[model samples]
Target: MTAPSAIEVQDLVKTYAVRGRPPVRALDGVSFDAPSGAVLGLLGPNGAGKSTTLKILTTLTRPDAGSARVAGVDVVARPAEVRRRIGYVAQRPVTDPMDTGRENLVLAGRLQGLGARAARARADELLERFDLGAAADRLVRTYSGGMARKLDVAVGLAHRPEVLFLDEPTTGLDPHARAEMWAEIERMTHEERMTVVLTTHYLEEADRLAAHLVIVDHGRVVAGGAPSDLKDALRGDTVVVEVADDGATARAGEVASRVTGLREVTTDGRTVRARTSASSAVVLPALLAALDAADVGVASATLARPSLDDVYLSITGRAFEAGAAAETEEVAA
Candidate 1:
C-alpha cells in the first residue's frame, strides 16, 4: 500500500498587493505531496513562490484560492490544529540570545503545551540528543553558529511535532555545519519518524537530503519526483564545451551537431551543450578534433551524468544560477 500523505496541497494561489504597483502573485496553482515520515524538498530560485507556499502551509499567510492540509488538519479552517501538529523552523534564528540553550528549549516545550517538569525533561533530552549537553547551560549568544542552529532544531522538536517545516535551514552554515544539519534531518525522518518539508535554494542540499523533490518556478511546480528518477529521465551524458570566445559558440554548436553521437546541441554565450548516448570518452576526442579542425579554440570541456541542475535546466529553460539571479533584484511580494 502507498504511504499516507503527511501534507496535501492543491492549486494554492496567493497574491499580495504592492503599493503603487500591480499585485504580485506569489503562488500560482502550486501543488505537491509529502508522504508520512519522508523528507520533501521544495526547490526553486528566488521569488519562485517557495516562501509563499511555506507561509500558507504554516498558517502564517493565507492563500486567496485552493486548499492545504497539514497532518490532516485544514490550514484555512483549522489553522491552530495544523500548528499543533507541525513545527516551523524559519530561515533565521528564533531563539533568545539572552537565554541558555537548555532554557530556550524548555520555554519552547512549555509553549507547546508541556508541563513545567515535562518541559525541563524534554530540554535535557534534546540537549543530549543534539550533542549540546556540554553547552546546555551556556547563553545562546556565546554559542557558535552550528551550535545555535542545532539548538534551534532541538527547540523545534521539543514538542515532538509530527511534521516539521525547515526553511533554508543551512543557508549560512559552513560545509561541516551543513553536513551536521543534514544528518540531523536524516535522523528526524528515520529514527524519529517525522515528516519534513524543506525549502532551500542550495541545489546540493536538495539533491542530498530530500527523498523526493518538487521544483517550483514562477509560482508553479515544474517538476516533481525522486531525484534519481528525475536525473534518469534526462537520458545520456551532458557535454559542455566552453569556447575561448563568444564568437566561437555558434561555430562550436555547429561542429558539435555534426558529431556522431551528440544531440540537442545548443549554444549559450560561449558554451556549446549537447547530450550523447555514448560515453564522453567515446565522443570527446572526435568532438575536440572537429573543433580544432575548424580553428575553434576550446577553453574547456566537461562531461557529467545528468544532474539535478540539468533536469532543472531542461524543465525551466535556463540554468539554475541564471534563474536564481533573476529574482535577486525584486522582492517576492
Candidate 2:
C-alpha cells in the first residue's frame, strides 16, 4: 500500500492588506500533496506565493480559506501539534553571530524542550554530522556563509522533527557552498528519512533536488509532477534556428512549421523555435531544407532534449527568467 501523504494542501487562499492599497491575494486555491520522505519543491518566480504557502504550511500564519495538514494533523485545528513535528529554516540566517555553533544548536534544542544533557548531545551529534565540529567552539561570526547555513539547518533538525521546511536554503551561498548544502540536504532525506518541503527560485536547484515539483505562478499551480515526467509530457525535442535578421524570424517559423512533426513554431526576434518528435538527425536536415527553400538565412541551429525551462516556456507562454523578473517588479510595487 502507498504511504499516506506527509503534507497535504487543499484550496489554500491568503490575502494581505497594505496601507492605502487594495488587499493582494497571495494564494488562490493553491493545492498539492507530498508523500513521506520526499523532497517536494515549490518552484516559482519571486513573489509567486511560494513563501506564503510555506508560511501557511509551517503554521506561521493561517490561511484565509481551505485546509492543510502536516504529518496528519490539521494546521488550522492543531497548529501546536504540527509545529512539534516540523522544523523551519527561513530564507534568512537565524543564528546569532555571538554564539558558537554548539551553543546555538544547544539553545535550539533546549527551546524544543530537551534537557541540558540531551541538548548538548544532540548539538554535538549535529555539529559533527554537518561537518561543523572542527569549528564548533568558534563564534558563528567567524564561520563561512556555507558553514553558517549548514548550522542553520542543523539547528532546525535538533528537535528531530519529522518534516523540515526550507525556504530558499541556498539563496545567498556561492556555487561551491550551494553544492555543499545540496549534498547535505540529500544526506538528510536519504539517511535520516526526513520529509522536506523546499521553496526555491533557482530552476537548476529544483530540477536537481526535488523528487516531485509543483510549479506555481501567480499563486496557483501551473504544472506539477516529477521533473522528468513534466519534461517528457511535452513530447518532443526543441529545435532553435537563429536567422540573420528579425525580418527572417517570421519566415523561419513558417518554414519550420511546414516540416512534418514539428509543432508549436514560435518566433522571437531573429530566432525561431519548434518542437518535433523526430530525432535531431531527421528533423535538422528537413528543417534546414525548408528554411533554405523559403530563402531564410540560418545563421545557426541547435536541438536540445526537453528541459524544465522549456516546459515552463511551453506551459506558461513566458520564459522562467522573464516571469521571475516580473514577479520581482510586482513585489517592489
Winner by lDDT: 1
Model 2: per-residue Cα lDDT over 1-333, one tens digit each: 876799999999998887898988888999999988879998888878888888889888899999999999999999999989999999888899999999999999999999999999999999988889999999999999899999999989999999999988998899999998899888878998889999887889989989999998888999999999998898888888899877878878877878987888877668787888777689889999888888888899989898887888898777687778777522312
When summed lDDT is taken over every stretch of 10 residues in candidate 2, the lowest stretch is: 324-333
lDDT of 1 by residue, 29-126 (tens): 99888999989999889888888988889999789999999999999999999888999998889999999999999999999999999999999999
Candidate 1 ranges with C-alpha deviation above 4 Å: 245-251, 266-270, 277-279, 329-333
C-alpha lDDT of residue 333 in model 2: 22
Candidate 1 clashing pairs, residues 3+ apart or interchain? none
RMSD of each: 1.9, 2.6
Question: Residue 64, candidate 2: how far off, in angstroms?
Answer: 0.8
Predictions in order: lDDT:
0.90, 0.88
Residue 223, candidate 1: Cα error in Å is: 0.8
